[model samples]
Target: MNDLSRGLAYTFATGLLWGGVGVFYSKGTEKKESFYGFMFLSALLFFLLTWIFAFPQGAPVREVLLVAALMFPAGLSGQLGFWTMKKALEHGPHGIGWCIVQSSMICPFLAGVLFFGDSPSAGRIAGMSLIAASLLPLSAQGVPAVREDSCSGRFLLLIFAAFLLVGLQQTLSLVPSQCPTLSAAALSWRVPLVSLVGLGWLGPVLFRKTGVRCGEIGWISLLYALLVFLGQLGIYRAIDFLGKARSSGTAYPAACGMSILFFFVYCFFKRRERLSRRALAGIGLSMAGMFLLAIS
Candidate 1:
């Protein structure tokens, strides 16, 4: 297959893995599992795997290391996005959380144009406009995802935070992308470092949570880490194969839309959650926006 096709395929598979994360991780959280602890374990496992399979190979790599330093904030931003995402999942359905987090496509597109001197096409403009417009309907959800008496504002804020934080994280990667030297090893080092930082905050929670045996939770967290790595690897490969423009502006957001599609179907078939009509409409609107973004 050609670069574009391979990129799109990888991107879509990434979305599938991400879509499943809602099911697996959310179920773990539902079992009264500690979110931080679970994340810590997953992060630890991911770090180890990266170190074993993708450890830094060059010596005195000052430039790449400097770029890696800049990439550190991207890791932090991702963790923040992850924290809000879990909380949002607690407040709403899996699809809602996915929608908010996936909507982070805007920042990358802006970074491409503003910093990289990339030209924006009319189709991209329209696609982005539709994406922005779709967020309104989601915020307009009448019923809260988690609670009957709870204010929808809380969930809405969670969604907004998820959108902003993850967007920032993705945009930060654009910096590394511009530097060919850094682009390849950027996340290889950054992900493990992020996992280490995650341990600092999430470690205590792992120790304190009741009945939280590491042995029992090992498989679940391992699965989470594997999924995380798969999704990240796919996106990274897509960017490398297809260039930052299509990967970010089109494949990235479009993959997110695919994720929401799987999530909506999962929720419907499993009958795990009650999805309102407006929520369905919001999802559909988001899908339309992604389609435009893709074809553009």
Candidate 2:
């Protein structure tokens, strides 16, 4: 296949893997499996993958340290984002949590424009506006009357927190790219180091008294790790191809948009989750916004 085809294929694969992550997380929560166990195994597997495949060869010590420093906050934010995402999914409608987190592309896009000297075009502005508008309808969707006041409020807060944390993680991911001293390979291996450090925080939680069984979540954790590794690889390859063609903008929004669509369909059919009219309208707007963002 040509470069464009390869890039698009990788992008779509990444989207599918990401959507699968959400699906598996939702399933795990339903089973009352420990998020800590899942995250720990996933981080460990990701670290092993980096050690085997992406480790930098004889890089200068200073450069290695610099990369580690840059990745630290990114890792922390990503871990926390995942935590909030799990909590949000546990309490709210599956589609709502997934959609809000996917919409976090806006965070990195704005960061690029304001901090990295990217052009702020009309298309991008309008796309951001549409995405912002969609949030109102999404948030307005009614919850079950049983716990409407408490559960609904908490769910919204958690999802919004997940969005910001994930967005910050994406924004931080951009920083390593701008560093002249860091090679892509060097940047890659250090990713798992920071991830391990982030996962370390949950180690204490794992030791706490809980009914969560490792046996129950073992396969789920392994699957989560495998999907994450493949997704990260797909994203790296997609960017390499698309960047050369000067169409890298298509990769992020395309993957995110596709993942959101995947979740909507998967939840509707597999879980029999029906969205209200306003929520459906919000999703439509969000998709349109992503399309505009991709083109911009």
Candidate 3:
């Protein structure tokens, strides 16, 4: 397959993996799992799986530590944003609440254009526009889930914060690729660093016995972590093939759009999720947007 096809394939897998994360997270919620504890544990899993091979050879300790330190803050910002998104879901309205998490993607796309020297084409622009616009139905959801007869300040703040942080996360994820030494060891250097921070955050929870048992959702969390690892791999590869701007403009949104379709099928058809016609229309628009993106 060509670069575009491979990139598209990787991007599609990225979406399914991300959707897997939501599935496990939903399971954790059902089990009343501690959010911080679960996330830390999952990050540890990703770290171990990715870095275990590199360590058996006894690589340079100082260099390894340096790489880990660089990635820590970037990963932490994303971790915090992820938790904040969960809070938004719990306290705020449904459509707009979740919409913010997905919509924060605009930051990376904008960054690509402004800083990364990415030039947008008509198809790319229109495709991204549709993908973003598809979420309007949810963002406009006012009555049942939201309070104050409108989208609340807290919810909007959480969304904006999440957008900035996740966008930063995406931008930082590209750092390793920009350096030749780190590029070849992208996952080796990056996952360990992020996981180091996760372990530190989880240390107290584990040592102090926070009463957050991972027994039931433990397998699911592991699955989620693996999917996350794979998704990151896919994103890096997609960026290699398409550049940051095209990767963000086409691949990231395409995966998100596909993931939404997967949820719509499972929730609306099989599980009887409370999906409205308007939401269904929005999902269809997103899928169409993905098609446009792929061929653009």
In terms of TM-score, the best-performing candidate is 1
TM-score of each: 0.83, 0.82, 0.81
* Candidate 1 lDDT by residue in tens digits, 1-296: 87767777787787788877766666566545565667777877777776676575453467557656766787888888877877766766665566667778778777866776555778777777776666666545422455552336677788789789889888776565566565354435554454455555465564675534577677888898888777766766665555654444455666666776676677667745556777677777777776776666
Residue 159, candidate 1: C-alpha displacement in angstroms: 3.4
Worst 10 residues of 1 by lDDT: 142-151
> Candidate 3: which pairs clash?
93-145
Q: How well does candidate 1 match the true structure in TM-score terms?
A: 0.83
Candidate 2: residue 99 lDDT (0-100): 78
TM-score of 2: 0.82
lDDT tens per residue, model 2, 106-178: 7766665676555567886787677767766765542223234334778879988999998887667666555
Error of 1 at 193 (Å): 4.3
Worst-scoring 10-residue span by lDDT in model 2: 142-151
Off by over 4 Å in 3: 53-70, 93-96, 142-152, 178-183, 186-188, 203-209, 244-249, 269-271
Against the hidden true structure, what lDDT does model 1 obtain? 0.67
Clash count, predicted structure 3: 1
Candidate number with the higher lDDT (1 or 3): 1
Task: Put down candidate 3 lDDT per residue, 78-182, tens digits, no spaces.
Answer: 877776776655556434544557666666666666766666777767877887888786466522333563466777777778767766776666554444454
